[model samples]
Target: MVFELRPASSADLCFARELTRETMLRYYIQHDLRWQDEAFDVAWAGRENWLICQGDSVLGFLSLSRDAKALYIRELHVIKTDRCKGAGSWAIEQVFSMAREERRSSLRLTVFKNNPAQVLYQRMGLSVVGEEDCFLRMERMCSAAP
Candidate 1:
């Protein structure tokens, strides 16, 4: 199925909340702190949060933080059923494309070391830069390929 993303609006709050929590639990159930409520709040309030819509359902979403020099993927959640189907990769590519267009020098994000998504991140050209607690901090250096 073709996935398209659009700006998330207030109307999507209910599904967005449930989708965020469900996706988080599918991957982060072992984490110590409960992040669903906090995440939902951020998504609802933050201007950088985006929703990926496929038809009428929300496929996944991402929250980002950006600065003059870099872009950070603050949160990324894809529905459990959508796993391994390129939705996350497409979302990530969208992020990278936007960053590149903005001339951001790099992209960074934190992922649970235990999450299988790490492998996908590595495949996408992000390398581990540091680690804090259970999170693996990664960065992708963006330079125009010669």
Candidate 2:
């Protein structure tokens, strides 16, 4: 399916919050992790937040930030119904392109160790760079643009 990333606005805050809460709750529950509602926030106004869209429908959203060293993926969430339909992969590819355009040497993210998405990251050529009690830090070296 065709998907695009659009900058998320204040108008999209509620949808982003609800989508994140729901998806994260399921993820936490399945992994036997604690869910703290107080700690949950979509940060919709963040400059790097983007809504994953197909036409008028908002399928999911991702939040990314960059420094001179690397592009970091702060969050990536696709509604449960939309998972496995290619939206997540599409979004990551867009981020990869963005990192290359910015001349970032690498893309980095932390994924819950038990989250199945870690497998997807591996498939995308990211390697484990470090690990925390609950998360695995992964990085992919971005090739220079041709």
Candidate 3:
């Protein structure tokens, strides 16, 4: 299926916020971490948020930020209904493309070790560069070819 992305606006906040909380709450609990209710809003203020769309349907959202070394993927959550349909892969590709355009050297993100999505990140060429208590930091150096 063809996928597209539009920059998320304040009007999209409710959908994106709930999507993130519902999808990520379990990982926080499983790891004994606090799930801050204001996390999404705080992140939205500083990141580039995008709504994943298949035609008119909003499938999910991803938030990206940049550090001196890499473009960081702060959050990525796809609706349960669209989980296996390549939306996540496409979203990663979007970040890669942005990294290329922005002349960023790498893509970085942190994922819970138990989160199955880490497998997808590795598949997309990101490797674990470091580890925190319960999260694995992953990175993929930018390349001319994806």
Candidate 4:
């Protein structure tokens, strides 16, 4: 299937918001309700965001931020229909490429302990650098040239 990757815009705010909500519901523990518009505003207000689309349908989204040494994957989600089909991997590779292009030393992401994506991260060479109660912090680093 053909895929399109594009930078997110204000016009996409609504879709992004719904995507986030659906993702949370599917993959996360149920929690109390909150104001969605406000939450979406806070999240999409800054940082770099991208949408993974196929034809007219949005398949997933990802966001990133960079510090001096590492690029952080702030968010990534693939719809249930598209999971395990390489969309998430392609999105992650894009982040890693951006990190390499910027001369950053590493790419990092946090995955919940129960998430199957942990295996994917390991396959991509991201080592578990640390862990919290229910989360794994992973990193992949490229050695700097002399």
lDDT of each: 0.80, 0.83, 0.90, 0.81
Q: What is the lDDT of candidate 3?
A: 0.90
Q: How far is each candidate from the true structure, as Cα RMSD in Å?
A: 2.5, 2.1, 1.6, 2.8
Score candidate 4 by TM-score against the native: 0.83
Rate residue 48 of model 3 by lDDT. 89
- Give the per-residue lDDT of model 3 (tens digit) for 1-146: 99998999988888988998899889888988887768768878888899999999999999999977689999899999999899999999999999987888999999998999999999999999999999999999995444
Candidate 1 lDDT tens digits, 1-146: 78887887677667767776765664555867666576667656765878887888777887788888888998778888877888888888888888887888998998888878889999998999999888899999886423
Indicate the residue-level lDDT of 77 in model 4.
Answer: 84
Pick the winner on TM-score between candidates 1 and 2.
2
Residue-level lDDT of model 2, residues 1-146, one tens digit each, is: 78989988777767777787786777687778786644545344444789999999889989888888799988899988888999988888889888888889999999888778998888887899999887899999997687
Q: Please list all clashing residue pairs in model 4, or write none if there are none.
A: none
Which residue segments of model 3 deviate by more than 4 Å? 144-146
TM-score ranking, high to low? 3, 2, 1, 4
Cα miss at 92, model 3 (Å)? 0.3
* TM value for model 3: 0.95
Q: Against the true structure, whose lDDT is highest?
A: 3
Backbone clashes under 3 angstroms, per model: 0, 0, 0, 0
lDDT of 3 at 18: 91
For residues 12-46, write the lDDT of model 4, one tens digit per residue. Answer: 77887777777764445523335456866786777
Q: How many angstroms is residue 121 displaced in model 1 relative to the true structure, after the best TM-score fit?
A: 1.0
TM-score attained by model 2: 0.88
Model 2: lDDT equals 0.83
**Model 1: colliding residue pairs:** none
